[model samples]
Target: MMKVLLTGGAGYIGSHVAVSLAAAGHDIVCFDNLSNSRAAVIEHVEAITGQPVPLVVGDIRDRDAVRGAITDHGANAVIHFAGLKAVGESVADPMKYYDNNVRGTLSLIEAMVDCDVRTLVFSSSATVYGEPQYLPLDEAHPTAVTNPYGRTKLMIEEMLSDIAAADPAWRIAVLRYFNPVGAHDSGLIGEDPNGVPNNLMPFISRVAAGRLPELAVFGDDYATPDGTGVRDYIHVDDLAEGHVAALDRIRAQDDALSVWNLGTGQGYSVLDMISAFERINNVRVPHRVGPRRPGDVASCYASPDRARDELGWEAKRDLDAMCASTWRFERTAAMRNA
Candidate 1:
C-alpha cells in the first residue's frame, strides 16, 4: 500500500476517496485549506475507515506548506483534488478559477518535483471535452472547452502531459470524471457543498427535503430524449474506487502518463434523474425549467471502454442506489444539523 497525500481530502470526492484508499490499506494524510470543505469531514472519514487520517490545514497554492505536508508525512504519491469546481461561478469569475485551480496546481506540481513524489492521480472533469462532437465522448475526442472551469482542467492536463514527457519518472494518471453523485453506503460522509450547490444531485436532494423552494431545471430545449441535458452520473463511491484502481495501475508501471474516463457508460436526462429520485425515495422534488446554463451541452456521457479495459474499473451502482443514498445522506445530515 502507498503512503498517499490527498490534496483536497476534506472535500466531497476527496473524503470518499480517502475511505476507499484506506480500505485498500494505503496510509493517507489530507492537506486541505478548508476553503470549500470543513474539518469535520476528516472525522467522518475516520469513523468510516476506523483509521486516523492526519490532516494538514494548508492551501495548495502554498508551495512550502504542500512540500512540508509531503515530507512530513513521507508521502510517495499525491492525489490532487483541491480546486474550484463550479462551472457557472468559473464563468463569472475567471480570475478566481485561474488563480485557485491553475496556479494552485502549478504550486503542487513544483512541490512534488522538489520532493521527488512522481506518482500522481489527478481529478479531472468531462467538461474538458466541451460540447460533444459525438455521443459517449472518448479520450480521443477533440478538446475545446467552452468555460473557464474546463479550461483550468484542460490546462492542468496539458501541464501534466508536458511534465511527463520531460521526465520519464513521473507516473501520472488523469481520471476525467463524468458526474459524481450519491453518498457512501455508511452515510457518514457525502456531498455537502457550502452555501448553494452547483451540482444537480444536491439541488434535487435539497428540493426534496424542502430546504430549497424549487429546483432549476436548466433548459428543456436541448436535443435529447426528454428535452433536457443528459449526463452519466456515477456514484461518488464508485468514483472513489476508480481512484484507488488508478493509483494501483500507475504504481505497477515503470513510467507512465494515462487518461481514463470514470463513468457508468449510461446517460440519464435531468427529468429521468428527478423521476428516479422521486420513485426511489417517495419524495416530490419540485422544479421549474429555466434557460440553459452557460457551458452546458445537450448530451454528454462516457464510453468507459478504456477505463474498463485498462484499469479494470467500471461504475456499478444503479440510478436507484444513487437516489436512495443521496436521500439517506440528506436525512442523516438534517438530523445532525438539528
Candidate 2:
C-alpha cells in the first residue's frame, strides 16, 4: 500500500475515492480548502473505512501548504480533485476558473516535482470534448471545450502532457469522467453541492426531497429519442473503484501518461432519469420544460473500451441502480441536515 495525498478529498467524488483508497489499504492524507465541501465528510469517510484519514486545510494554490502536506505525509502519489467545476459559474467568471483550476494545478505539480512524487491520477471531465463529434466519445475525439470550466480541464491536460514528455519518470493518469451520479450503498455520503446544484441528478434529487420546488427539463426539442438530453451517468462508487484501478495501473506501467474515459457505454435521456427516480423512490418530481442552456448538448456518453482494455476498469452499475442509490442518500442527507 502507498501513501496517497488527495487534493479536495472531502468533496463529493473525492470523498468516495478516499473511501475506496482506504479500503484498498492505502494511507491517505486529505487536503482541501473546504470551498465546496465540509469537514464532516472526513468523518463519514472514517466511519465507512474505520480509518482516520488525516485532513489538511489548505488550497492547492498554496504551494507551501501542499508541499508540506505531501512531505509530511510521505505521500508517493496524488489524486487531484481540487478545482471549480460549475460550467455556468465558470462562464460568468472565467478568471476564477483559470486561477483556481489551472493555476492551482500548476502549484500542485510543482510541489509534487519538488518532493519527487510523480504518480498522479487527475480528475478530468468529458466536457473537454465539447459538442461531441460523434456518439460514444472515445479518447481519440478531438477536444474543443465550450465553457471556461472545460477549457481549464483541457489546459491542464495539455500542461500535464508536456510535463510528462519532459520527464519520463513522471506517471500521469487522466480519467475523463462522463456523468458521475449515485451514492455509496451505505448512504453515509453523497453529492452535497453548495447552493444550487449544476448537475442534473442532484437537482432531480432535491426536487424529489422537496428541497427544490421543481426540476428544469432543459430543451425537450433535441434530436434524441425522448427530445431531452441524454447522458451516461455512472455510479459514484464505480467511478471511485476506477481510481483505485488507475492507481494500480500507474504503479505497474512504465508509461509516462495515460488517458481513459470513465463511463458505461450507455446513455439515458433526462426523462428516463426522472422517471427512474420517481418510480424507484415512489416520489413525484414536479418539473417544467425550460429553454436549453447555451452550452447544453443533445447527447453525451463514453466508449469505455480503452479504460476496459488498458486499466482493466469499466463502470458496472446501471441507471436504475444509480437512481436508487441517489434517492437513498438524498433522503438520508435530508434527515441529517434537518
TM-score of candidate 1 to 2 decimals: 0.99
Q: What lDDT is reached at residue 323 by model 1?
A: 95
lDDT of 2 at 312: 80
How well does each candidate superpose onto the true structure, as a TM-score? 0.99, 0.98
Q: What is the lDDT of candidate 1?
A: 0.95
Question: Per-residue lDDT for 1-338 in model 2, tens only?
Answer: 99999999999999999999988999999999999999999999999999788999999999999999999989999999999998878888899999999999999999999999999999999999999999889999999998889999999999999999999999999999989999999898999899999999999999988899999988999999989999988999999999999999989999999999999989999999999889988999999998987777889999999999988888888888898999989988878888
Q: What ranges in model 1 sit over 4 Å off?
A: none
Model 2 misplacement above 4 A: none
Query: Tens digits of per-residue lDDT for model 1 on 231-274?
Result: 99999999999999999999998766999999988999999999
CA lDDT, every prediction? 0.95, 0.93
